[model samples]
Target: MEIVLYIAALVAAIGFLVLCVSLAMTLTSLKKTLNEVSGTMSGLEGQLQGVTRETTELLHKTNELASDIQSKSEKLNSVVDAVKNVGESVNGLNTSVRRITSSVANEVEKNEEKISQVIQWSNVVLEIRNKWKERKAIDEGRSGYSNFKD
Candidate 1:
């Protein structure tokens, strides 16, 4: 019985030593994991800062482009107004030409009767002159002249 007691005491001491070693190893592993987490957090922060700077620059550039487009739109509007003015002027000229053409046509219509009368008078005059020349030639031939005098 005394020998058995000594063996039992030795086994308890060995078990206690094994427990202490396991606890130490667990603590060391936990410390290493915490360090890795800290390193990863620092890397993420650096990336976030870079993204923030780039986003600020992009916003500024977008605003500048918008301002430039606005200026160009204003210029384009002026050009469109000028073109509209030109179109109005051309329409006015077209209206004037149309009025003049109508006036000329009206005048020509009014003169149609006078032109017809003049043509009739000219024809009558030509026929009378020819008849008069024939009569004079016949009269001279009967009067024993060789030819009618001019």
Candidate 2:
């Protein structure tokens, strides 16, 4: 009965030792996994900082571009205003030309009858002068002397 008790005690001790060894191995594996996780978290933190800096720079550039575009738009607006003024001036000039042309046309229409009367008077004067010259020539041939004699 003593030998059997000792054998049972020895078996219990061996089992306890094996359990302790297994627990130690599991703890070691857990520690290694925790270290890997810690390393991965640090890398993630570094990437996040890089992204933050890049985002800030991008925002600054966007603001600068926006201001530049605004300034250019202002200048373009002035140019467009100048073009509009030139177009207005051209329109005014064209209107003045049209008014003058219409006035001249009206004046010519109003004077058409007077112009025809003047032409008739001129023709009558010319015809009278021609008749007087013919009479003078006839008298000169009869008297053998002309009014144009020096």
lDDT of each: 0.94, 0.97
lDDT of 2 by residue, 71-121 (tens): 999999999999999999999999999999999999989999998999999
Candidate whose TM-score is highest: 2
lDDT of 2: 0.97
Candidate 2 — number of clashing residue pairs? Answer: 0
TM-score of each candidate? 0.54, 0.55
Tens digit of per-residue lDDT, candidate 1, span 9-119: 989889989999999999999999999999999999999999999999999999999999999999999999999999999999999999999998899899989989999
Q: Give the Å error, residue 54, model 2.
A: 2.0
Top model number, lDDT: 2
TM-score for model 2? 0.55
Clash counts per candidate, in order, are 0, 0
* Location of the lowest summed lDDT over 10 successive residues in candidate 1: 141-150
